[model samples]
Target chain A: MLCYRAWVETRWRFLICLTVMLLPSVLYFHELGIFPMQHWTSDPHYAYGLLFGTHLPSIGIWTFAAVFLGLGGLLRERAVGTSTLTLTLPVSRAHVVGTRVGVGASETVALALAPWIVNSSISLFERTPFSRAQAGWCVLLLVGGGLVYFACAVLVSSVVEGEYTAAALMFALVYGIGYLADHVSGFSALNLYPLMSGTRYLDRNTNLFPGPMPWLGILASSSASALMLLAAVTITRRRDF
Target chain B: MIAAPAIQTSSLSKYYGRTSAVQNLDLVVEANRITGFLGRNGAGKSTTIKMLLGLIRPTGGDGTILGRQITNPELNRQARAHIAYVAEDKPLYRYLTVAQTVRFAAAFYRDWRCDVAGKLLREYELPLNRRVKALSKGMRTKLALLLALARKPELLILDEPTEGLDPVMIEHLMQTIVARAAEGTAVFFSSHQIAEVERVADQVCILDRGCLVLDRSLDSLRESFRRVDMVFPVDVVEREFQLPGVERIRANRRQMSVLTSANAEGVIERARAFNAVSLEVAPVGLRDVFLAMVNGLESAIGKEN
Candidate 1:
């Protein structure tokens, strides 16, 4: 846990990006004149409501934070030669890698739920209905996206040798997948940007408007994440360091 | 008669793609002795140490470290716990303070001696609060040794632990190694500092170009190899000064320094026949032995070429 905290303190870019991710939702509520008091509800002008309404885009924030933070955690130690010290410990390599991944995932989950909790609390005073299941599902999808992104970051860190090169490669991957998903119809399944867009079954009646539910995309992403994690563990176990 | 050797390798070989880094390495590090692994740059010292620690997979043969199989990961981990390794580069976490690094190392070993760590920090006068990156090269090496020593391991594998330090620090490091060996911890370290090794190590292994050229006890080494200093008469011819069993001979004016592999008797006989005025045969130390071996290898290679 101290390792995680130390990493977060050193990695200011990750903190800045996380702040930027939350800014849109916070500003959306403020723009609608319901930030401190009422929560953003379904408005007559916009069918999809504001970004922080029942259809808040928490998954996007979660995925971005997870990928950025996860890569930083895994790569910074190696870049600074701390991984050599970490590996020399009596603990198994798997345990060290798992602890780092677990801490990164935890941070992603916490960041994902921040806006939801704030909105839910304010909705109580604003006389707007808050569905606990809808928020929970949103958090779950964000976690799933985070898990996938975290696994991808771990794999990238293992394969790339240098710090700057690995980070550049990760950025390229995130943006490349997102750009392709937006333009190509078939590639959206691979895009991690719109994590909860496929889960329409859970948000039918609520003010939240879910997009086309692609079950195959969720299944594929989950499987890829599992495989990436397995590969990372294998590489770590067999590595010479 | 003797306790089982703490570390033994037989016909161990490791290859990096097409090049062989360590070939047919045979070594036996006995219990309760300080062994110095002496070698020139790229002499396979680091490669052999890595194989002994099971860090790199050996291409041929195997060895036992602390009575455990080398290839087995679980046993390797267990064996590693009993032995402490300080790498050649003295690599450490730059972001962590000295105290944090010590604590981090303590978290792994079951028998971590925090008291020893504390004592060493005080004894060495290390700044525990300073970040490792802020430390000087010598300080980093001390902290690395401190981390390894705090584990109370039975065997300590140090690779060039004192490569770049002042004479005072080198002497202090040698004293610390001697103190540790006195406590019954077997210390095996590599160094190019022959005088330092001669001061503390009982056993010496000399490596040259990925081969173990010389391995012997320091006492036996001194007895067998001798440096004979002789002053030939001014009338004696230089060509007539050549003697059998002489490994190396260097002369200036009337004095000739002959490094002989034979005992003092043979060197004396040759010196007398050459009409030498004065002859002194001094016992050879690691420095003499190392120079002889390296020069011998270079000459042999020169001849081959």
Candidate 2:
């Protein structure tokens, strides 16, 4: 029932994100009939060099969705006058926090996988040659390099009060880090965007990640995500509701 | 075996930097009885409840619920299995239907009584499919009460349980509270309604400014508390009215009114010696006691300062 409660609390956000993320993929390209025309076959690389030719800028959209998915928990419930009900439950705070995060992270993975797969099926229906391996790598890279954003949002929401306040701070923090990664040499290591979207490995001629994957980057990013989630749980457990 | 007190706190205090929310409160609420926790707004009643439930940590002292340590998270979590609480706001998930909220709450406790929940559902006439956010305030309070009462816990903690209820429903709820206590469930509720508390609570604890000023059984209070009205000659020193049981003495030139918790007869004897023109002793009700304890305490502090 904890899982059920978490799902009920966040089901709308998940569905809305799924609908919005798939909107451009389902309607935007198909309406223009770009897939039926010769704009793709003549060039070696796809239009705008979209990752794997079917991602729909999958990393950026999924990161935003992840942050939205992580917007609520005990602290956010505190702001909304529901934390008392939650705290009065017989379960440990850790169990409640874990269940919420587990549901959200599962939704995050679904966000990453479902959209790209649907896009790949659309590519097949349109007679385009989108590689399944390329789609798989896009998912691996997106999840491995992108879950930290979800974890970051969770930590911020766990400690901060007010939903809009926490969301604004999360966006500022994410975009600020993105800006730093672009300009500052010291922050180049923080540039998760390129890794998640696989822009660096994108073949200018093929728009595909053709070589070996970044195992070190994935390990490091996944570790950071784990650490951030642990921090969120600790904050939830130690702090007053 | 004798059961431990449903709640026990020793010097339990919560301080926020320089501000004290709850200060040095030592309270014990035993099982199988109704204990009304009375206080005005911001008197630290809610804060004390939160600390006892492990929703917030106590900064200065230690406490226990059902004999388990409140400071120990694991022990407190274990203790909550037998404790049911309804918050002052009746905080239910807005996204969930009334049925879903009840179902979700039932899943957490081993003591959940489905028969009672079903009975309450019909009694309260709560729409099972209606979202809680769409329910009326009175309906929301009913739903919250249903959730707590259905738990059949060893201890039931309710904060402002009767707020936003109709008279009929409040009456039914009062009967239900008494029935629950008769069935061996201890009830500790906080409310501003002194009349309701007087009707239902076996014992009353009045809190003011985070301090517990009065804790006594209702029978004892009725027997011992009194208001003495007297008119003495002019120029009688107020200090002469001092006695062990005199709680407060109000003087207006010659006429004096004395409130006493005990020794009302002794106060009357002194009044006779002072050549009182008129004197009358009346039983003090719970409302007067609460007001004098809370507002009168403020006046006492003012006079001392």
Candidate 3:
């Protein structure tokens, strides 16, 4: 029921993110007439890249969603007038944070899969071939890297007091860090924009399918997400309701 | 056998930077009784309760609730499992319906009593399907009480339980508290309402400016505390009546009023020694005792500042 509570609290934003993430893929399939062209003529590799690249908008929307989802835990429950009730529960603060983070991260993974699911349906309907392995890899990379933003947004939301302030601060921090990663050669691996969209890795080889996955980037981004969540838990534990 | 106190705090102090909220407080609340925590606004009643529940960490000192140390998070969680707390505002999830809120709260505690929950659901006439935000203030209070009472916890702590409640609702809530106490649940509730506290509380602890000024049983307080008003033919020196039990002494020309919490007979003898023309000793009610203690503390604090 805790999970249900978290979902009910976040379901609206999740729906918004799902719609925003899947619309472009659905629209692109209809506009390009890629269905009739078939797999051999249409170049599924480039089509896959374009469809997945549209993930940038989804990622942007998801960063806000992640922060908003994470906004109402112990730290912000004060604004909602439920902090005392939440804090007094038998569960530890860490468990409360864990449930919230788990629910939110799951929603983020679902958002990452939105494009894949949409594209796959279109491919199946058109008898246009799609690589399950490539689609899985895209989801893996996007969620792995995108979760860093989600976790970072969680961290910011945990610390900042106001809702809009936390969201604005999360956006500024994400884009500010992205701006640095874009300009600095040493920080290229840290850029969330292309990392979430699969565009940065695609620059080297257009064929993301049957191609070597960005395992190093995935490992690095996933580690960062873990670290941010740990920090959030620590902050929550030390906080006095 | 004397069981361990349901709650004990020694030198438990909470200081927010420069201001001290609760200072060097030693409190022991016995089990199987309704203990009323009475204080004026911002008198550290809620803060003390928060510290006891580990909702807030104490800056200094320690406490134990149901023999579990409150400072340790793990231990506090263990204590909270058997402790039902209704906060001052009686906060509930606004997004959840009354039934959903009950279900969500019941999931966390192992001792949740479904029978009591169902009974309260009907007794309060709370709309099970109505969202918490949609409930009236009275219904919300009832719902919060229902959640706590349903737990049948070993210890129940409620802050300002009857605040903003109608007289009938307050009476019903007091009855429920008394019923819980009768069932051997050690209930600690804070309130500014003296009459309700006097009616239901077996033990009363009064807090003034974050310090406990009076801790006594209601019956004992009524028996031992007294108001002696004497009309003397001559003015009496205030220092002459400075007895061990004298809590306050006020002289207005020939008439002198003395309040004391103990040794009332000694006070009467002292008044007679001063050749009091007319002497009347009255039993101090809980309301007057509370006012005298808190008002006396306020005056002393005022003088020092």
Candidate 4:
């Protein structure tokens, strides 16, 4: 039931993000080709890299939506005078926060998959070879890597009371990281832009595995997300309604 | 076996930095009775209620509801299954329709009564599909009440339940409280409305500046508290009348008025010893007792400053 309430509160934002990414992918594929047509079929690595780059914006958009989903806890409820009613229910604070986080995370994963679904549909209709493994890797990397921003949103919403302030702070942090990653080589691996470090194109001509995956960066991002989520839950548990 | 207290607190305090919101409030509300928690605005009435429900953590002390420790989150959640609370604002989800609101609340507990909910929905004339934000204040209040009453909770706590209610609604609300108590549900309500408190509350607890000033059964208050007015030919110092049982003493020239909460007879007998020309004793009403308790504290604080 709490999940239902969370969905009711967040479905519009999720749908908007999904539509924002889905329509653009379909349209981009439908329109006249900007790059050569042979690039898509002759070199699968270049095609995958191009696809990954085009869908990078979707990660940022999903992060925005996830932030909004995380902003519906006691502070927001108190503004509407419903916090008392909510807290009085026979449910623990952990359950309420857990349900909201779970719902928001689920929506985030689904949003991450929207572009892949659109690309796969286009590939099938056009009779072009689509790598299931590459598509699966894209979805996995986007979700796993993009969770850092989602967790940042949850942590900000847990602490900050005003909606605009929390959102603004989250955007600043995300954009600030983007700016730092572009300027500094050391932070490039941590850059969530370009979607999964823009790998799958180490050699543009061939799709062969010579270098190992960026396991350290992936591990760092996943751990950061978990830490931020745990912080949010701890803060919420200690708070008064 | 004697029934246990529906609610009990020991030194329950909430402090906001240097200021105290509620201070060492030791209170007991017995089972199967309507107890009115009376206080002036900002007298910690709402704070105490919030603490009892575990909506907020206490800064210093703790309480229990239905024998479950309120400070423990798990225990409080367990206790809440049997508690129904209506906040002062009568809050409901404005985005949900009235019917959906009812359905949402009913899904939480195993003891929800659809029959009572249906009866209240009809009597209130609440449009099932009408959004909560579109409803009038009175209708919103009724919807909140319906949600609470339909559960038939073991304890019902309302804060300022009749604050903006009309006379008819107030009367109906009072009757509902009495009916709930008759069904063996302990009702604890906080209000500034003394008349309603006197009419419905079996016991009254008055708080002032985070401290309890009075806690007694209404019948005992009526029997003990008295207003004794006296006229003296010669002027008498205020300290002369500060004997036992004297709560507040007001003096103007040769006129002296005294309010006493206990041993009224003894206080009056001493007044005669001062060679009073005339003396009058009147029974203390709840309003007068409440005013004296609150005003007396104000004057004391005023003198300190």
Global CA lDDT computed for model 2:
0.87
Question: What overall lDDT goes with each candidate model?
Answer: 0.71, 0.87, 0.82, 0.82
Tell me the TM-score for chain B of model 4.
0.95
TM-scores, each model vs. reference: 0.82, 0.93, 0.93, 0.92
What's the lDDT for candidate 4? 0.82
Tens-place lDDT per residue, model 3, A1-241, is: 6788888778888897788778768676775584446553567566656555555566676666665555556666776789899888888888888998899888888877878788888767766656677677777767786777778877876788764777778777777777888897888766666666566456435555454556777788889989999999999888776
lDDT of 4 by residue, B1-305 (tens): 99999999999999999999899999999999999999999999999999988888999988899999999999999999999999999999888889889999999988899998999899878999999999999899989988998988999999988866678878888999999999999999998889999999999999999999899999999998888888888998888888787888877678777888877787678778888898988887788888879886234323322
Candidate 2 lDDT score at position A93:
92
Off by over 4 Å in 2: A23-51, A123-130, A202-210, B297-305
Model 4 clashing-pair count = 0
- The DockQ of each candidate is 0.33, 0.85, 0.82, 0.80
Worst 10 residues of 2 chain A by lDDT: A47-56
Tens-digit lDDT track for model 3 on B133-180? 999988899899889988788999999888767888788888889888
Q: What's the TM-score, to 2 decimals, of chain B in model 3?
A: 0.94
True contacts kept of 1: 0.30
Q: Name the weakest run of 10 consecutive residues (lDDT summed) in model 4 chain B.
A: B296-305
Query: lDDT (0-100) at residue A144 of candidate 4?
Result: 72
